[model samples]
Target: MSNEQVVNLNTKNKKINNRQLVKLSIFFTSVIAIMLIFLTNVYIVKEGEYKVVRQFGEVVRIDDQPGLKVKIPFIQSTTTLPKVKMTYDVTEEEINTKDKKRIIIDNYSVWQITDPKLMITNVRSVTGAESKMEEYIYSVVRSELGSLEYKEIVNDEKSSRGSLNEQVTLKVNELLQKNSIGITVLDVRMKRTDLPSENEQAVYTRMISERESKAQEYLSKGDASKNRIIAETDREVTELLAQAKADASVIRAEGEAEAASIYNQSFSKDPNFYSLYRTLESYKKTINDETVIMIPSTSSFAKYLQGNN
Candidate 1:
């Protein structure tokens, strides 16, 4: 080949090589992009979650099974939602009780998504569902608690709290079901109960007063019982004393009668000796250290003193 032919051939070969390199680069770039699209379009569905696939911002399918899931790239998108139980701490609120008392109630609830499609359609998101749940919870709780007294709600020993919680939970579930909210409340519980800060002191004072009044009432009853017992005892003592005195009087009369009979018999057995003894006994009774007496000499009383009997 001549020099001109050689130069043209070299330039043409170089152009062909450049064209092939451009084609190859384009092919590899397309392959890499395709692979990236396929990988990015795939997702994992966990056991406790639901992967919702939406087309054009609308839900088209839901994958709840635990495995690899795919959606059309750039056309469909997937969002995950928990299928397991979730807890929501409800905001504390103040409510009036049946007894016209106000109390602050803090509550919590356990909930689950029964149908993610329905949930997404109605509530749109977990946060939205929780917000709605909270509304129902507060409403039901308020209504239920409003029918109960403060003591029934707060005092554990006298509480109707279990029934209250059940009523609230049931009512909340009913509302959610009625509205097709796609969630169910398994339980609703009152975490804490307290008097409002402004009312606590007043309630405490009133409680103390009530306890003191009760104590006073018991003391009054005890005093009345004690008095009744004392009165009964006094009556019994008086009766016993009177009976004892009557018995002593009867015995004394019997003794006196027996003594009189004995004295009469003794006098009859020895009339002269008995007369002398009686006279001497009378003399001793009438005489004393300062004794002053006057008697007729002819009288029988003077006869003993004069030794003339």
Candidate 2:
């Protein structure tokens, strides 16, 4: 071959190799870009989350399943909402009841996102749901409380309060359903139902006074009962003692009468011995160490002392 032809061939081969290298570099770059887009577009739906897929600010789909998921790259976005139970603490506010008394109510709610599609359509965002829930719950609580007396709300006795928490739960659920908040209200509880700060101390004092009054009443009743028991016991003892005294008198009289009858019968049988016994008893009665007797053949005690009769 000629020198010029050989040079042209070498130049053509170099251009072909350059084109192949450029194409190879472009192919690899395109693959890397596609892989990056796929990686970036992927998202995970955790066990307790529901993801809402939005395309250009509009909700297009909902991913309820938990695992890896992919969406349109750079065009769609995903927002995850908690599917587990959540709680919202409602703010404390003064509410009027049927009795025309104002009270402060602090409440909380347990809820969960049940339907992702409905949540997106109605609430749009979790924060939006929370705000809407707060409004709805406040309205429900106000309305329900407005129909009850302040005494019912603040009763310390649970039975006397008459299922207040259940009423609140039912009312809140109804209101949430009406507003389409797409949340299931598991429970609604009252943290506190109390009088305002300015009135609380007065109410407490009144309660204390009432409790003390009741205690005093019980004490008085106990004392009265004790007195009645003591009086009855004293009456029984007096009656028993009087009966015993009467019985003793009757028994002594009967014994003395029987003894007199027996002695009369014995003395009538032996007159001389009865006289001797009477004389001896008289002498025994008349003689003692303090006795002063005039002698001169009179007193038996003088005869015995003088050893003559």
Candidate 3:
């Protein structure tokens, strides 16, 4: 090849190789772009989530099954929502009871998204759904609690709130369904209920007063019972004493009568000897150291002394 011919051929060959290199670079770049698109469009759907596919900001479909999933590149998008239950701690709010007493209630709910598409259409996000659901929950809870007295909500032992949580859950679910919020409440409960700071001391005072009143009532009843028992005991003692006195009088009279009878029988059995003994007793009484004998006593005593009775 001549020198000029060689220079022209080398330049042409160099242009040809440059074109091939450009084509190769273009091919590699296209492959890399395709790979990047694939990677960006792909997502993994886990067991406890729902992958919502949206096209141009509008929901197209929901993939709830677990594993690798894909969507159309640059035209579709995926958002994840929890398929499992979630707990929402509702903000504490004050509600007036039927008795017009105000109290604060803090609640929490266990909820789950059943339909991702419907949820997206309605609430657009988990936080939005919770916000709307919390409103309904507060409304229902207030309505239900407002129909009850303060004591019924605070006093667990005497509470008429047997199905209070259930009622709230049912009413909230009804509201959600009516509004088509696509979320279902599994359970709703009052995590805490408290008296307002301004009213707490007053409530405590009232409760203490009630307890004191009950104690006083019991003491009064006990005192009345004690008095009744004492009265009954006194009456029984009086009756016993009266019966004992009557029985003693009857025995004393019987003993006196028996003694009189015995004396009469003994005197009747020895009348002359008894007369002599009586005369001697009379003489003994009449003959003291400074004694002077009376006429009738002297006649009987002299006759007895002379053995002439």
Candidate number achieving the greatest TM-score relative to the actual structure: 2
Residue-level lDDT tens digits of model 3 in 69-170: 889988999888899999999999999999999999999999999877777888888998999999999999999999999888888897766599999999
The TM-score between candidate 2 and the true structure equals: 0.80
Score each candidate by Cα lDDT. 0.93, 0.83, 0.90
Q: Per-prediction RMSD in angstroms?
A: 6.1, 3.7, 5.8
Model 2 CA lDDT for position 108: 88
* Model 2 C-alpha lDDT per residue in residues 180-234, reported as the tens digit of each score: 7788778878787777888878878998999999999999999999999999999
| Backbone clashes (count) for model 1 | 0
Q: How far in Å is the alpha carbon of 195 misplaced in model 1?
A: 1.8
lDDT of 1 by residue, 265-288 (tens): 989998988989987798789888
Model 1 root-mean-square deviation = 6.1
User: Which scores greater on TM-score, model 1 or model 3?
Assistant: 3
Q: lDDT, candidate 1, residue 42?
A: 93
Candidate number achieving the greatest lDDT relative to the actual structure? 1
Lowest-scoring 10 consecutive residues by lDDT in candidate 1? 300-309
**Looking at model 3, which ten-residue stretch has the lowest summed lDDT?**
292-301
* Pairs of residues clashing in candidate 3: none
Clashes of 3: 0
